[model samples]
Target: MRELVFALDYDPGWNTLADTLADFPDARVRSLSLHATADSLWRVDHATGSPDALSAIEDAFLTADYYADCLATEPCGADSETEVLDETDDTLVLYTYWQRTPVCTSIPHLALEHLGDGLLFETQHEQRRHTWRIIHPEDADIHGFFDALHAELSADVNVEIIRLTGLSATNTATFSAEEGTLTREQREALTAAVHHGFYNTPREIDLGELAEELGLPRSTLTYRVRRAEAEIIKQYMNHDPVSPSDPTS
Candidate 1:
């Protein structure tokens, strides 16, 4: 379950963003979430990195300063002008602005150093500003995207953000079908068909609905299911038949 993240500057813009990942054929970025603050020009509220999501940037806490502070308090959410607050440190982090809250500085259940690692990657002489970023799973086919982003911003920014709040550190895919029962595609299609309520009693599901759920055109699904049905019927009749499309006839 590898993932990609992009935490670019607010003004760098999406053309620059697209230019950065232009080579990746499978890149699936669909939207961007914009967050506006009083002082800074703008920040990447969030970005798309999933098949199920378009784009959404909400309140994310990197330190204790924002831990207890209410996010989404404004109508426009974390992007609102009225939600601005004081920056007490050279830069604002959790305890630096929120006082001695244990959540930021000292939580026995977790090591604060782990959080700090992602916040700022440092060398003796260099650091980069970081922010929340996301990459679509479809974007993984574009291996160059991440490398290009790192190269493009390495000279100017101290840090960049990638979203993991919804991603699994590891994914376990379990298929219920036996090896002879179905092909991987059928197993996947069946699971997706279940998403359409195809197995439900009323037969209320539309073929288009099942196709959409399975991420295929209804015509393709119809062809596959018909072929499969023909096979099932032949097997039930204790006879074998060449596939309709097979040319060995």
Candidate 2:
């Protein structure tokens, strides 16, 4: 199995929340999940920013061009089935269901659906980056897939392959490389934290120092490290290899 990760840049004028984020460059959208059915696309968008920025973010969706087919929209800060949709300055969540459009009209989603079982669409930001996990079979034509994808994208949009794994003969791991792994930023933050004695008894480096080293704001670094640690702990505790009775555990 092979996984391909890509950072997709969408047109500024497009309706993607990525475009809206451009309106507030400092704001970051941590995409929780996105799933597309035959008729509609469901997405959970999590955003964070200053009070003024969050105010503008709330208005972004209200005026978003992407929601033209939005059959129903539960605005952020409202009590609903979704838990994280809170009315806070630093955090906002939106639950959206969008009508499916043509391939030419929708750059990535339409192309992803065409891959069928050969490729799995993982996650995407409004205008920043999108990741996909592709499992290659012996008979699969990987090159052809890329060709078809490029044909749909405009010249301005750039696609970059961030990483590739599980191809060497000596490597016999059953799992796909990079499958369900921490994101690049998360990985870097966690790695840096460990090196700076973040997990040590005395804690050599604080959040401020770590954020400075990573060139990210203190808040951003805190979020990244926490999310990364949560994922690592989740994977370790849930993994099937460890037995409850094992002495190592």
Candidate 3:
């Protein structure tokens, strides 16, 4: 299969970040900042939300210095260890670093701003229109991260694969590859159809033959084979990276 690479200029990983912080009402999350680590997990310092803090989130655009750090070769997990990482500042935004396995490495930086101690963030994700996300974690103003990412995605947009990850009770999308979700039975039926030349250029094989050999009732066999063909076609049509423009009068 052909491969295509696209970026998530705006990603919404922090949707629950703010809600997560609200859990602690009394002790406002403070000293919040984002830092990349050699391992994973971003160190959020002074994770709190105060009035004066929330005002500092919007800053920087057009130019952002990409910070380089040691890259981790292994995948990160919820149990991944994070220590009091480094600290730095880029003009307006301050960095309170820590290591937490990033959900996806492809996601670049976050828009940050100070909100007392709480932080507001934004990320760029790609689908059709670049999906932009805004987040207010415990404490910080992350407006810039989102801006740069959005800009990058729009700078020169192209078709990109959207990996379905992180599922919750209400969340839906879960396909990694279109075929990733196929069941064993589905795979078997599809394989049989393909092998029997059912999908061969022309009239191909008859349903009765497939049903007899595959040990399925004719109706059942027809449904399964049709379904399998549809899935393959759907995936092919959906996964194509470069596509021809639609002709319209």
- Best candidate (score: TM-score): 2
Task: Please list the C-alpha lDDT of all candidates, in the order they appear.
Answer: 0.30, 0.52, 0.35
lDDT tens digits, residue span 27-144, model 2: 7665566665555556677778777767766776656544522212222222122234666758888776565534212323444444444434455443343344444332343344
Candidate 1 segments exceeding 4 Å error? 1-181, 239-249
> Of the pair 1 and 3, which is ahead by TM-score?
3
Per-prediction TM-score to the true structure, in the order listed: 0.23, 0.49, 0.25
The whole-model C-alpha lDDT of candidate 3 against the native structure comes to 0.35
TM-score winner, 2 or 3:
2
Highest lDDT: which candidate?
2
Candidate 3 lDDT tens digits, 120-158: 333321121222222333223223332333333322222
Displacement of residue 93 (Cα, Å) in model 1 is 80
Compared with the true structure, model 2 gives a TM-score of 0.49
The runs of at least 3 residues in candidate 3 whose Cα sits more than 4 Å from the true structure, single-residue gaps closed, are: 1-177, 202-204, 243-249
Worst 10 residues of 1 by lDDT: 120-129
